[model samples]
Target: MDILLNVVNYILGFGAAVFVPLIMFVLGLCVKMKPGDAFIAALTLGIAFTGMNTITSFMTGAIQPAAEGLADKTGLALTTVDTGWPAMSAIAWAWPFGVLCFPLLIVINIILLVTNKTNTLNVDLWNVWNLLFTAVLINYACEEAGMGTTVAMVLAFVGAGLMAALGIKIGDMWAPSIEKITGIPGVTVPHSMTFTAVLMFPFELILEKIPAIQNNNVDAKWLRDHFGIFGENSVMGLIIGIVLGAIAYGELQAALTLGIQAATAMVLFPMVSKLFMQALSPISDAVGDWMKAKFQDGRELYIGLDWPIVAGSNELWVLTILLIPVELIFAVVLAPIGNTVLPFAGIINTCCAVPALLLTGGNLIKMLILGIIATPVYLMVGSSFAGYCTRLAQTWSPDSLAGMGENPSITWSTMECPDFRWVLVNGLSGHVVAIVLLIVWLALFVLLYKHMAKRNVEIKKELGR
Candidate 1:
């Protein structure tokens, strides 16, 4: 176990940009891909990841200062600090079981695949921290309850494995539509946010039943046709930036700078994602061919990836920008409802809203309504978990949330945030209600899969499957 852990650390030490591509190159070679094609694919994947990091950095640099200014200007004495996702990740990696997470998850995936239980070959390893985060939360809970480290570790592995299995089911459900958009075969995003689309499935159906809403639906196609060039995501991003900037900083220069930044982020995200897809093409083909030949059947397998390839959808960007103000307003006016953490507009817009829109068929109206529903969930969860997060950080890595604020703790508006919080409240803390809710959440996923499967023929046609 020590040797395996050491090997995992050494490989992951290079970071995702290098490590992921290196692993893919090795896997490609093992799969009998041409040496030149495998090397090019791996190199291109690295380049794509590097470009993505650059764009994300620029977006963070532009939006974060303004967001901080906005929070300060509000003068709210918020007890809970918003330390952001990086802090949360730091806490995850610091936990003792963190060293074991990578090999455990990889082993789980391989087991599932060999047993024919899941066709999703999840390669989005960089986000494995999420699974680790879940594990640590459970581990902390189990330890507090007098469970032995071995038992805690086993439970942690169970939690992480369950999430991966859930991701496979989700990737299978959403892959066809994603393929249509990116023109890349056999790939889907299976992150936490995309999984939340399951929760929205029933609501979407209810909304569609109402002709008043359905007939008057203002979707992406409507925007493209009515607004012409102004409806384009780049311009919409600029407009959103100008609005956000003006709100964050009451100066023309500041507003213009922010507007350009938003526009650049909106444009660059899709562009960088396309580079990723291009790099993935050869490997995707090789895997698909191998699967069909080995299985002796034409199974529609998918690679579970991160949420970049489908970023091009105009509905996603537009709805995300529109929800920024809504999230902020909820944070301020709804403080009574535990809205301590001010919404980080940039992260929420990119991470939460886009996945919601994509899973709901890019229906802008549905997406907006989902955002409205999700706001309170974020606020209450973030606020409630702030204390636990603070304790965990102080106990595990005292400096993890340092420099955010005094006694700073972190929370997230990302799709995984609520689930993480709920696990803490229910799974670890022995809150029966949370456990029940989780059971219901899984039940909802089952219902959603069945519901979608009933319309399989229609969905496949729509997705060009």
Candidate 2:
């Protein structure tokens, strides 16, 4: 047991950027790439991920202070401190059974791939804890319902398997959207974050029927053409930063500095995303060809990836950045309904924003609307999950939340990416309604898959493929 924990810790200690490229390198070798070629591809892939991580960190570091400042300006004290996703992740790894989720998830992924239930390989190793969190939560739920530890453990694994499959399907479904938006091919982002689109998908359908919202498409290109230099994401980012800076801190020099920084980050994203595409193209093709031969059915294989693959969208950043303060205000307004967790740590909220960007076809106005609509769900999930999250923290890292200023609970909006926080809460409450909700959720996915299949066909036609 100690050995297993040590090994898991060591591997994860390398972090997502280095770890993902290693997986790609091994996958490259398995698919029969020459070692030298695989090495080059792997290194390039790692570099791309590093760039994404660096920029993400840059944005978060730059933005969080203003976000926290906004929270301070609110002058309201919420009971639960939003420790963010890292706290949840740390708690998952600290759990003894956390390491066991890897094999369980892998076995499920293999069954899914072999049975043609899903094409995604679920190789985004770093985010496995997302499912692990569900497993741990379910384990507690079962135990709370008077099931013993052994039974709770079994049910937890069962829940994780279900979620793993759901996540894979979500990733497979979104591959076409990712390709359509980024023009990148043969790779799918299967992170739990994209699962939030499952909820956004319904709203998307409703908007589809309303021709006014559906027909009027406003994307980055549209902004660039209409607004000219100022419409460009870089310039808009500059303006937004100045506004946010002024809102948070009334200093002109600080606002200007933030404007320049935001502009630079916005412009650099496309360049790094291009490097990501360059690195991924060869590995993706190799895997697709290899799978076609191996399957004997001419089916293409898409390399499952992390969220950053799609995070390059200017639309995603725009929605996420703009919503940071708005979300905090919503939390304050919604406090009467048990929203105890303040929006402090996970303020950017790209997990939900990125998927909405794809689903709405990057209509800035629509994405913004969906974001506002979705904020309550996030608050509810975080507030509801706080007790469980706090228990986990108390069991594992008791001192971690001491400085956060209240009955601290983790607010990991990433896990709520329509990732079934409601379902988790229902199941944990030992209600039969959980079963109905689960069935409904899966049924929705069935319909979503069909929708995606048709959409993929249309996209292929458009691409002249």
Candidate number of the best TM-score: 2
- TM-score versus the correct structure, for each prediction: 0.90, 0.95
Q: Give the range where candidate 2 is weakest over 10 consecutive residues by summed lDDT.
A: 410-419
Query: Model 1, range 3-77, lDDT digits (tens) per residue?
Result: 765676676578778977887798788768999999998899888888877776777677777766677677866
Best by lDDT: 2
In model 1, residue pairs whose N, Cα or C atoms come closer than 3 Å (at least 3 residues apart or on different chains), thus clashing, are none
Q: After superposition, how far is residue 362 of candidate 1 from its true place, in Å?
A: 1.6
TM-score of 1: 0.90
How does model 2 score by TM-score? 0.95
lDDT (tens digit, per residue) of candidate 2 on 1-465: 789888989999998888988999999999989899888988988888899878877887888888777778889787776666776688778887888888878898899888988878877978889877888788877888888989888888877887787778777887878887778788888877766676777887888888878887877888888889988878998999999999888889888888887888888887788877877888888888788788887776777888788767888888888888778888889899888877767887887787787677689888988888888888877787777777887787777777765555565643455447568546654779987886677677678678878888888788776
Tell me the deviation in Å of residue 121 in model 2: 1.8
lDDT of 1: 0.71
Model 2: CA > 4 A from native: 402-408
Candidate 1 stretches greater than 4 Å from native: 1-3, 143-154, 212-221, 401-408, 413-417, 420-425, 462-464
